[model samples]
Target: MKNITFADAQNLKNPIFIDIRSPREYAEDHIEGAINLPLFSDQEREIIGKIYKYEGVSQAKLAGLNFLSPKLPRLVKEILAYKEKGDIVVYCWRGGLRSLVFTEILRLVDIYVYRLEGGYKSYRQEVVRFFETAKTLFPVVLYGMTGVGKTLILKKLAEKGLPVLNLEQLASHRGSVFGHLGLLPQPSQKRFESMLYDVLKELKGFPFLVEGESRKIGKLFLPKELFQRMQEAPVILLELPEEQRIKNLLRDYQVDKIDIKYFLESLQSITVYLGRAKVESLSEDLKKGRFYEFTKTLLREYYDPLYKKSTAYLRNIKKVISGNDIDELVAGISEYWGEFTGRDLK
Candidate 1:
């Protein structure tokens, strides 16, 4: 058996990551893209742990071996598939007994297996390291007022072969007061870093674009190294007309087709900015099915001010007006980015 680091395994042409932790631990948060070939199920693992603590190592080993005896054939089959193809990297919580035992099992079948030296926990430290020193990566920060379509344009840029990281999407957030309303549950911090580490590993030689965001996207804090890189990178600002922004906001908010009650509750937090009269007016519009007017009014009264406050926190931004068109917005920013950074967004 060989030992590998997260970075080394990631750089492999086609490395298969085996997550050997219990299903519960795997479910809570794990290295992104890892497949759980659990060494034990949640209940079985719990029982084994209790035995180890209360009975002794001998009893725990007996229990563990019994659990493994039945699964070994199936597990060996899976390991052989990877062995036939290429290198297989296995990891458990701490690169301790579980992974070592699994690797030994694979080796007994004459399969080459590598265990991560310190498992997922150690990989997270590297992610934190990457985030803390992101300036070296030279990421071009995508800056915009809210609802300016920065994230969508980042998607478009990525589609056109630019290296891009959609941080908010990874975090399942839109990065605003109203942004979290429609988002799915965010990944745990370990999982988030793992996902980040996996994606960044794929971009070795190219410059990448990242959304200019605060350290925290909703609840998950940006990795320290990455957040610092964003702070130092030169910015590309995107703009759009108010009417177009309202239209974009309507589609993005999903209020027309989604549960209006959720949207209503989200708006309550904006009451301070919208004032009692305007909030009542908008609330009544929701009841009356006058959403377009409601959106237009809300943009003018609430979102625009919020945008000003959010952008005030960022610096060194170069503006690219998107006019009333999303395509124009994407094109203008792409062209300028290609020219200024020498990283083609074409």
Candidate 2:
């Protein structure tokens, strides 16, 4: 099998990366855009590993070969399906037996197979390294307390001919415990970076506004470089009155779907601070169609206090813009962005 580097692979508009590892491993992490054409299923790999340890290499090889033999035609068909589109590169956990065997199998069919030199492990290291150094990308930060419509506002700014980098949208997550309330499952970190890079590639070299976020969003962590950049970036705070904020949050949260059980489950994320009885009382209120009371109680008892602490810490770097009335938040965001771009507000 021929070899290729991660840098070269990434530069390809499309490259078929066959990750011949167990599905479990792929689920944990894999190179973005990789297709899992495993040489062994999860359970089979476990059995093979045990056999190799107790009965030695020869016994393990025979068992693996036997398992792969029946699946050979199936594997070839799978590779051809993806291969019909682009150059195919395949690898396993390491530059080890699994991928090598599969590469040879494909080569016999006259397909030029490129094996990743150090395998998925090395690819992961490269991704981590890139993330560590990536913050040099120059990000302008977007900041706001919970439910100020910052996310929706970001979308509006992008629509109005402003350059914006929407990290939260890219991550398929909103950057909070309740962030996943109505969204699809988040992409793996590898996919997140791939999406981030793709977005970054679209903008000219200049300051771009991004929502303020911690290093990790849901199960994915921002690469070290981008995370540090976000932490140090200039912040633009979007503010709204408490009443408007609550109303906007009600729409954002979709109160019609906020059943008591789900509400309690969300509150459970903060059980250490809000005791169980308090949570239960709030839940009871929601069960009786008292959403306003539940939301008010949550804000007074939990969310508002936490937001104050967070805002206090961010005060120096934050540029606060308050009283963004519901009808005006979008236009306000656009005007603010226009000011940054040196354009008269339209």
lDDT of each: 0.79, 0.76
Candidates' RMSD to native: 3.0, 4.1
Estimate the TM-score of every prediction.
0.89, 0.82
lDDT of 2 by residue, 1-346 (tens): 6888877876777888888899988876777668888888899999999999999999999999988899998988888888889878898988888888889878888877789988987886775665566644667676766777777777877887777887778777777667677778897767677667657655644667787777888888887777776777667777777777787777877767845466668778877888888977877887788877777777777877877777532743535676657447666656666566563211
User: Evaluated with TM-score, which candidate comes out highest?
Assistant: 1
Q: What tens-digit string does per-residue lDDT give for candidate 1 at 1-346?
A: 9999987887888888888899889877777777889879999999999999999999999999999999999988877876777678899988998898888877787777889999978766777776666555767788766667777878888887778988988888888766776778887877777787778867863577888888988778877777777787777777777777777778887877877777678778778877878788888888788888888887777767766776543566655455676788777766776677654422
Local error of candidate 1 at residue 168 (angstroms)? 1.7
Candidate 1 has which clashing residue pairs, if any? 131-224, 131-225, 131-226, 132-224, 132-225, 133-225
How far out, in Å, is residue 67 in model 1? 2.4
Lowest lDDT 10-residue stretch of candidate 1: 337-346
Off by over 4 Å in 2: 155-206, 215-225, 268-280, 312-327, 335-346
